[model samples]
Target: MDTRPRRRRWPIVAAGVAAFTASAAIFSQIAFAATLFSDNFEDGDLGGWSKSGGTWAVVSDGSKALNQSNSGSENAREFAGDTGWTNYTVSARVKPTSLPGNGLAGLLARAKSSTTFYRLALVPGGVQLQAVNSGSVTVLGQVSRTVSTGTWYTLSLTVSGSTISGAVDGASVGSGSSSVASSGRIGVQTAYAAASFDDVTVSDTAGPAPTTTGPTPTKSPTPTKSPTPTPTSGGGGSTPTGSWPSSTGSVSVSGTIKVSGSLDGGMKRYCCIGDGSQSESQDPMFELADGATLKNVIIGSPAGDGVHCLGRCTIQNVWWEDVGEDAATFLGTSGGDSYVIGGGARSASDKVFQHNGNGTVHISGFYASDIGKLYRGCGNCTNHYERHVTVDNVLLNKAKYVVGINTNWGDTATLTRVVVQSSSGIHVCAEYTGVAKGSEPKYLGDGMGDGHCNFTSSDITYK
Candidate 1:
């Protein structure tokens, strides 16, 4: 039963452009460091800070710290000291007493107003950096790091020129860039969470001026453009004798290859591996060798997996359309790191990601839609092992999974800032032990799907 929907290419392409080029404008500016404002919250009141939207107060015992007690839809913030500073650093000691329904607490720097700012959030599953401009939100980076409630942690966020960076405790989490709102106020922020803060400080940094760099023109082999995949024909035209696999094709690779053009499958299906079905070819258009790095390529509709990557590989800035099975498959000899960044795979009757072996996979700025399963760990939980998968800042639409968690095998699945719409969502298997934030129907109940598996503790949110 193939339950995936047929999706168009334009929307996916547009999203790919936005996803990959998000930091293009901001990354050009260089940054330096300086001190701005520091608040220890020694007073027992919210005196110099401006409150917006949620209930906020300052608590005092032997020490003083700011607190917010709202667990509702409205977010809470307290702006203090500066509103004209840009390219600054904000740091604080914070503790979250309660996190309700994907709640978050963190620092808000370069805030334009109550609704607009650069946010670096610390949640139950991980850390996220986002840019909110004129009420529109854009997630810049998401790093998976499990944080517990009622624990004090130091969070520091720096915006130097166009670069935005964050750190927790002492180690760096992740960094992202945006030039949307250049200058604004510094504040503390929380969403759907009740938290307390102390020793808040803000610093203005000296940064380099922004500059634009143009591309250098050079002659190269022109890549092929394959036709979109359709139900009737396998893909578009047939593969020419000298292209791709053939030595004469525009794509020639010994180890790593970056294709600037699209690939045509020639409507041919190579029958080998697929999702439960063997009649359909499971072979990818290009079977990547181990240690290969493939980037900047558009994979046309293939009969099987679009690119079968073995061992450690890096796939970046690639768009996939009209695939028969998973868009990309990561198989490890033992285990390794497979990275999928800044691209999307759509319109598959099978899963978007097929993990058949044990490995660590990082997928970020990735868009997946219209697939039977968003992620397929082990087929049978007791049979094979599961891989460590971290999905960050991903947008999933019209996708469903039969067993969302470790169906039969390996380990943790950490999902952050994932937006799900009109989808069956994921099944929470007993073996899965991670969190899914900003996504609904995150777990399976007693009588749902293949029946529920019992577990001691689960942070999964079910509706």
Candidate 2:
């Protein structure tokens, strides 16, 4: 049986993050450097970040950073990650600019709320690690050391199963066991203090040498896969806010890079491939072998052929700066599954996804803009396969058509929570008549059909 797409709503992450874009916004989960989320707040806007009981904005403190500027708000808090983040490290540069005598500037992990989380905080008398639940606080570990108001300190907090550990400026502050909150969001907090935070980042820190952590940087660095499989539910501990992200850095690809296990780009821009014009001979920048997984990568302009999957694969939290020939192509025929989750694509002069294989392609919590087609089932491929796709919680920004399918081949597309951001009138599902390899596919009418498109007008929303 096919699984219904699960909707994920997380916070505004950095460019390095997998879901939404912000500072570093490098998103992926599993092991060391598998950055699931980060934000420098350089974009000067908090698009996907959530706030509670605080006055917050992007303020320059050395550089762009999220700052809570209200000392009177006793429980000022801001979140920039998913509620499903578990077994990860959340770190940030924190400066207590206006702390009261007993106020605290803290970094939070497994934050279920503004007051509920495991915290590594700088207090007046010292540093403390505590578990706070429903506004109630319990100290798990503490170290006595005075902190300077104007000085910056690196606060690092790691949560694994029941073990919680924290550090300050590379120095161990505390480690202990706690069950207060096992899994939640990542954020920054202040209690009776105003502070500036920067370079906020979350990376995978548990599971052995992280050998299988993710992308060992081989071939050039030869990448490795994390022993941990990303939950089919969440990739970067965050949900996208339906906007494009900035690139923290860029990688030039000379040729197609083959991925055998998994490759997490940590949300870097991979470009230098082809021209923006449609060309059939353009090589893909990355190719995934059967069962391979690609995460937290941004495909920049001239994006040859975005990504190709030979068999079962997962495209998690990947953004396309510009759509190439196609954003991603699924060529798997093994009746396995492929997923496109939590990312956005823009300036797609063509289709965003091409399905030329068997089995199902599930896309959930995704954003698309100015595209010819968000998804297309192979219309004239040599092999006749029954393809299926389920799209849920997606924002279609001025999209021409949501999905195009070959009705003759028995292709099916299911759409839900599709927010259409344009009055241009998009085709929810456009049907086509498959032809031979040499002929063009014929276009058919669109609407909910018995077996082709399984959705009603209620499944779509106009904005």
Q: Rate the local accuracy (lDDT) of all candidates.
A: 0.57, 0.76
Candidate 2, residue 227: lDDT? 21
In order of appearance, the predictions have TM-scores of 0.39, 0.50
Those runs of model 1 whose alpha carbons end farther than 4 Å from true positions after fitting are 1-34, 208-463
Judged by TM-score, which candidate is best?
2
Query: Per-residue lDDT of 279-348 in model 1, one digit per residue for the tens?
Result: 3355465566655655555554443456777666666655665557667777764555677765666686
- Provide C-alpha RMSD values for all models, in order: 18.7, 23.5
Can you tell me which runs of candidate 2 are displaced by over 4 Å?
1-230, 233-239
Model 2, 1-463: lDDT tens per residue? 3232222233434554443334233543433346677677776777756665568888877677788888976567776776767788888999998878869999999876444588899998778777764444667666777788888999988888887777887777756667888788887888789899988878765542221121111122111212223346546324446767767788988889899988888888988787777786788888999888888888888888889899878888889878868989999876656888788888887799999887678888898888889999988888766677878888888889999987655566878888888738688899888787878899988948334576788998898
| Span of 10 residues, lowest total lDDT, candidate 2 | 214-223
TM-score of 2: 0.50
Q: How accurate is candidate 1 locally (lDDT)?
A: 0.57
